[model samples]
Target chain A: MPKMPEGTVMQRLAQLLFFSALMVFAGYFSDSPAYQLLESGQTELKLVVRHSGNIIGECRALDTGEIAALAPNMRRPMVCPREKAPMRVELDLNNKREFTETITPSGLHDDGVLALFRKFTLDSGDLILHLRITENPDAGGLPRDYEKQFQVDAHSTLIVEYTDSGFSSWQPQHSPRPRL
Target chain B: MKVEAFLDRFFPAGSNPLYQLGAVSFFLFWIIAVTGLYLFIFFETSITGAYQSVESITHEQFYIGGIMRSLHRYASALLALSVTIHLIKELGMKRFQGPRWFSWVSGVPLIWLLFASSLGGYWLVWDEKAQYIALTTAALFDYLPIVVEPMAFGFLDGTTVSDRFFSLLIFLHVGLPLALLLGMFIHIQRISNSSTFPARGLALSLLGAMVVLSVVKPALSLGPADLNRPVQTVQVDWFYMNVFPLISETGAGAAWVILLGITIALLLVPLIFRGVPKPIAIVDPDYCNGCSWCFADCPYDAIYMKPHEKLANHLQSVVVADKCVGCGICAGACPTATPFKSVNNAYSGINLADENNAAILVRTQEQIRQHPQADKHVLVVGCAHGPQIDQLASDVVTPLTLECVGQLPPSYLDYLCRKEGVDSVLLTGCAPGNCFHRLGVELQEARLAHEREPHLRFKDVHVKVTTLWAGAGGETTVARAVAQLQQDERIADAKDA
Candidate 1:
């Protein structure tokens, strides 16, 4: 047989080596984090809501350390004081709705609007709140209105009613409104 | 005229032994597959589990699983070796040129598949090498697009990427082998009468070798893979991984592209060059005996026994041209030497000068005889077998003394045909199962059909020119065979003749 062309064997050998290395690397060293998360059980969830063109009213339980709200302008911040007892925030979106339960804290904590939003697990939906304003009629008025509903689908939001006192027919601010 | 010559060239009358080797190698692949499937059921594809599974086969399941693994590995290595050798032999013999080019072209992808399959086999271990390989592959993919989940803080959730990484590896391990099997099938479609199985002895011997090797140097994993530790050095199978170092230099994608380009070029080589018209062996109507040696001996199912209408002397004869690789085993099988000469039989009846014919034939034969002192020069005089004569001459140092100025050989002539300094012999006899000596030719043909060489057949070496004829009564048959042999200018005229 003709002497194999010069370097032909070597070239073939090199190719085999390269591909083999690639396969090996792909199999063993693939360090994807998603898998690690699934393995480690250290899952963290973060939620951010911004309203561009509307007035919004929102309430949150600051004690639970759940949600955080960031206003377009950082100058005004509201912290919802921890309630004496565990409280729930019900959100109604489009038509469907869900509620989040939060516990009150013992020590003094940030009562800002941002802190209150973080306290509860608000299901994605619209917000229709019925609350008993304890201190002021319009004190740190309800959280700004967001066009988009929190619930996964439209017409869904939180509908809150203050149960401390007999149910009152308070005009709904329809804060955190569903946006297109 | 060019078209006719082209048609006649590729469709030459004879069989190629390389084609036979390819056939046998194909069967070997199937053997590998059946065995591989058995092993795959037991194999653990995971990094941590793979090595242990393989070890279990060797330690616990030695009788069945171990044997299967050994067979699979051996078959893989053998398949690669056989294909490479087949390619080299064809190239050296210049058989890859002409109509046989597509086979050569398709061969490149086949080589790639072999490598892919072998590499995937490596990963099944998930050893240190596998770990290193995994990291390297991930790095390669990192260069591609990385989609961002704005809700998430990081550019990539490392966890997601890692999950995909494992999925991809698993997919390749399972999928590539199937593809390789498909490629093997396509590689042999063009050639006829190719053997799918190696000789039983040869198969057994190959399996034996694999067993010995596996026992002596069992495939071992290089410890558990550590992502933090860099693999500085590792034992590499040069046959499969010679290009790894190049990857370090040129970068992976560039190396990959260059290698792919080279493979494509190698595969398409047959289309890049041309060769002499494929010579077809033709038979003289008068000399045939209706015997059937060529039909039995033809490696490529090129020859067939057909009833003779014109000649009363012969009952049935072999007819083949398009499927022939012109190996000439058929011509060598002819008893009456009815199919004489390598070129068109019509070329012999052109009535060239008598003295010229004598001088050329005698001179060519004499040169062959004299060349024994330098190196065994064997003059294989035949018509349809001419191309093979050229092939043998180019490969073996022996001078091929040809004689187109001739007739088919009788039984006595077969015994008389001999050359000095010849280490081996080859004759392109007429198509198998169709000779004149009432089985005499077939018997002689049997002697030439041994499978002595793994990459070559003795039948291929000893050939017959089963198509070209020298006309009636065998008067000018010898002269025509002699004339066909003289086409090679390398032969010097003998002073005595």
Candidate 2:
């Protein structure tokens, strides 16, 4: 067997030691308590909506000439809404409601845009999430409402969004951010 | 400097036994498997029992449980580290090129399989890290079009948590490792005598280190997972869980893109800058003496001895062309491969086609002997893959380049020193363990030592012989050795006077 220089061997051993030490430091010692807590097992579900539902009985198609008559810079939405709806969310586990919230639509706003946002701490198990939005509850016999059910497990965040097509769900496929 | 040179400097002979990163990974896997099996025996897979079972293992069975847990975790982290190193080392050494694509390609999926196994193992613990992984993995799965409902629903509230879900986690924890083991087997299928384990000393040292780390800071859980409340604090094993943070920064789509892009890039690397394929070794039955020397020395297991009724010797060596790496080690191993001798139709039983032949060796030796210098005349034989032999001062030394130094039979050294009247011979090759042909340098060492068959006879030869591990950067070392041989020869002549 060819002999390796002793100095070179010692130098390499030092390098290996340094690398292992670096990994150990990064794994255990590189975080604050608060930041570590956020990354722990805590499951925070953040829900935000950017748009209100746009459900129309019928939408009229506008010609280019009609748009020119209005003004070059003026823009009109293609869909016409009868009434804006208040959003309601209910969290059910084993057929029992754990959380329920009613988000009323804005009365004075022309678009009746009601921005809904909520955060919840979910337990571990099967969960049924029911979402309903009524444009105008008093205008008709029953409220003009759209409802959908979502099921979520523990340590997960489910984002329920109100879009033009009713409720679109978004859940982070990863844990919460590093709050630290 | 070449990557081989860098490795040679660090892992000197015997100290770097089976130091290939892939083999290190295999050793780490064994450690994890053994420790994991010990831990699993005491583990409870039920949702309610999972946390308590682990706590019992840690608190009640502190010595065994704590140590095992730490070993499992550290070994897992080390496995991940070693696999990454293996990938980088192969990339640097150009081991992914040409016919060597199978191992490289299979290795990509093998990494994912390993990750999946580790992820499942974490989830089985049902600790804070397990909870985090479960939730994060669930969310990530929900992002895919294949998942209709968030798998996270099962973990949402304790009311919905069931033994079946816990069983699934346990199943995956067990199943993924089995799959990883299978994938590993496939990864090295194309390689002959592929070392899947590190040396005993290195393995024991690594095991000892992990054990010490375990005892020093036993792998503690981040408290038991509470479904009603979020976990307050925990230390993350960034090695396996780093992807979650990445997914946190970039949405799952982009994360998938980054992952898939890296995988695709790795898979396609062999196709880029591919060199022209070398011809495989072929067997000539008529010349084969059924010595089985080639069969024993073939690095790729491409040769086998078979019984043939037609020949004077019933056993003849055969070359499996598909498996042959065309390293030409077999041709050098054959006793009948004295291609330089003035014989009719000189050839070896198993020889590489076109790339290396007996004719080339005979021709090259003839050219080297064309010089008229009689005293202190030396022949410097070196590997083509290493430093070029031609770069030596050609006045005193004639250069002979072989595909690898191992491909030159020990008799070739005898022929040069005895018949060719060369005063001395200096043989140099790539440093040991860094042989591009895997076992070339090792075989050469064994042959020169006369510890193996087809040994060179040193009868009537008083020529000074030296072997050097002069890689591409070792030209100065080779030159110095040659000059010393000449100096010694001159001293011998003066003593005679």
Q: Enumerate clash totals for all models, in the order shown.
A: 149, 22
Indicate the docking level reached by candidate 2: incorrect
Model 2 Cα lDDT, one tens digit per residue, B412-452:
77766777678888888777666777778888888878887
Q: B132-181, model 1: which lDDT tens digit per residue?
A: 45444443433232311121111111221233443455578568877876
Quote the positional error of residue A118 for candidate 1 in Å: 38
List the lowest-lDDT window of 10 residues for candidate 1 chain B.
B147-156
* Separate DockQ for every predicted complex: 0.02, 0.10
Let me know the TM-score candidate 2 reaches against the reference structure: 0.76
Model 1 misplaced stretches (Cα beyond 4 Å): A1-180, B1-31, B45-79, B135-175, B199-201, B226-232, B281-298, B302-444, B447-497
Q: lDDT tens string, model 1, A24-134?
A: 432222221111111121111122211111112355434332223443463233454343222233333344543343322222331212112211223333443322222
Model 2 chain A: which ten-residue window has the lowest total lDDT?
A29-38
Off by over 4 Å in 2: A1-43, A46-180, B1-12, B230-234, B307-313, B339-342, B459-463, B492-497
